[model samples]
Target: MIQRLLIIFIYFTGVSNSTAGQGQATLVVTGSVHGQLDPCG
Candidate 1:
């Protein structure tokens, strides 16, 4: 869906920009999801 396309766009952009220059780069991913808890053991 929409999420998959967003992930691909971010990946390609990061790769292309890095190869074109030599400089420090930063990537930050932030989000908040509200849903039912799932047991993880």
Candidate 2:
């Protein structure tokens, strides 16, 4: 039981970290596109 819990905890931590990084990357990409297209606005 303890091993299972540890595995789950590690899995979720990794997923969360990857997801956070992806979210940040997406935001940066979108922001760059927006800035280019709406430079005059």
Candidate 3:
């Protein structure tokens, strides 16, 4: 569980950082994911 959460955190952080631009908002919609859905905690 910890490992999976870690991977997700790293992935999202990397993606948001790379894709996000100045004065821009990143709309990340995670769906169709089994096991853990919605935001963690």
Candidate 4:
């Protein structure tokens, strides 16, 4: 049982880490788009 729990924890942690990385990437892309739209600023 302990082994199973550990596996689940590790899986979830990996998934969350990946999701956070993706979120950061998305933010960076959005920032680039905004800069293009408002070049005068």
Q: Candidate 2 — which residues are off by over 4 angstroms?
A: 1-20
RMSD of 3: 6.1
Clashing pairs in 2: none
lDDT of each: 0.40, 0.57, 0.50, 0.57
lDDT by residue (tens digit), candidate 2, 1-41:
45654564565556557866666555654565565567583
Cα error, residue 12 of model 4, in Å, equals: 23
Please provide, for model 3 over 1-41, each residue's C-alpha lDDT reduced to its tens digit, 9 standing for 90 to 100: 56776676666667667645312323331432334565653
Give per-residue lDDT, candidate 1, residue 1. Answer: 36
* CA displacement after TM-score superposition, residue 33 of candidate 3 (Å): 7.3
Order candidates by TM-score, high to low.
3, 4, 2, 1
lDDT string, candidate 4, 1-41, tens digits: 45654564565556557866666555654565565567584
TM-score of each: 0.41, 0.44, 0.46, 0.45
Cα-based lDDT at residue 18, candidate 3: 63
Superposed by TM-score, candidate 4 places the C-alpha of residue 23 at a distance from the truth, in angstroms, of: 0.3
Which residue pairs does candidate 4 place in steric collision? none
Model 3 weakest 10-residue run by lDDT:
22-31
Residue 7 shift from truth in candidate 3, angstroms: 0.3
User: What is the lDDT, from 0 to 100, of the residue 17 in candidate 2?
Assistant: 71
lDDT of 3 at 39: 66
